[model samples]
Target: MSGDFYSERPLFGGAISSTFPLRFQDVSDIRQVPDHQEVFVDPARDESLIFELLDLKHDVGDNGSATWFLQDLATEQDAEGCTAISKGRQGREAQNLLTVYLANLRLKAVGTDVLIVAHEPILINPLSESATAVGAGLAVPAAQSGCMAMGEVFKLAVSSFKVNDWSLFGA
Candidate 1:
């Protein structure tokens, strides 16, 4: 359909970074760096954030992609206590909190690529794991079709089974 064709174009293509908020900065004391320190000061990046990996959006635009907004759900103190507080009074509190954060990210990403990255374990508990297993946009494609669709037809095209009518759009 038109939706799939629009999603497969490359007029708005780009990749999303892993984490948005927790980026690396200059470390005054190099020795203070932990062995598992995820933050690394990259001179090339300057103030930009770094991520483990990114999801490639092939057809949105010329090399368009979306980086995920990652946050560390780990804590130095008692995780059980925090989890209890998150689920004790209100069962939906924790999910709601995360959803609000993601919604804010989505809003901030109105003009650019936005992705939310969180570990499976941290995002869901054992008993309630299946709830978030499918994820927010699992059934939907990762392409950003909003801006691309608004452009002229020259910027969007779709692949087809036959070559007789190259103007056709699909698959």
Candidate 2:
């Protein structure tokens, strides 16, 4: 594998702010599509939407909001969407929502991943190191891909803040 990940588009783009990752035994519930209007806004901007993890560790908290940044690729065929069904009773909303938006673009998670779970948004302080680090780190990938993979970029942002085995509903 190449040390430097090659991409025709940016990996930080095309990532949407999803409700949460639905747990399932199979991946059949996921599919690929082109219409991101339901999951994203603008669909052109490759900016990071700040999100706070709820009481749980990983993922956006129960009452959290994250920006869905994405870019639908035209080339390449391998595309993956989010889970169509929710397994637990906790997942009543965001059912069948596409979590991964892949199209001719591949993004790799590096060692820069970090998790910050709290009851409130800690990103409000612009001068804080956490905000700066997250902003700068995300900006690098955003700039690297030239904002090509908007969807992937948003996903990375989620991945960056998501904690291990952390549930949004605290289940």
Candidate 3:
């Protein structure tokens, strides 16, 4: 962390921003990432961070939504032996309207460790026709030596995340 340079970087046309180490370079364009996602990568470490806007899953409960999403992601990727290493919720204010859920998963099939940080907005903006929640996922190779550092970076990014323009989500 001492050697890493952290900064707030704009995403989705500057509508949203998050702080993370500068070592991660934006690669959404080159990778042809979906419009709903902003992708960043640290090539040297083969680590990636992805921020996504998604339609809230009405069927899923808030208590363990992060773990649910993590497992869903694992299934989507056809990753086997997915195990949840940790899960928790953040934010205590009942009036904040947004609850953050975090889940760390180990995907044995892919040999990758994934940290899923999800924000579930209790009230969906009427202006937003589909988008309801925002989430950030960080992936690090299982054998990586600096996984903890990357995990810290992921936490910083999620905590510092801000919506400069709510209109980006049609608010």
Give lDDT per model, in order: 0.24, 0.26, 0.55
In candidate 1, how many Å is residue 150 off?
36
**TM-scores of the candidates in the order shown:** 0.16, 0.19, 0.63
Angstrom error of the Cα, residue 64, model 2: value is 15
Which candidate tops lDDT?
A: 3
Write candidate 1's Cα lDDT for 33-137 as tens digits: 332122333221211111122223334443223212212221321134333213224344333112111111221212322232221112433333233443321
Error of 3 at 72 (Å): 0.4
Which lDDT tens digits does candidate 2 get at residues 117-149?
A: 111111222332333333312233334534334
Question: Using alpha carbons, what is the TM-score of model 1?
Answer: 0.16
Clashing pairs in 3: none
RMSD of each: 18.6, 19.1, 16.4
Q: State which candidate has the highest TM-score.
A: 3
Model 2 earns a TM-score of 0.19
Candidate with better lDDT, 1 vs 3 = 3
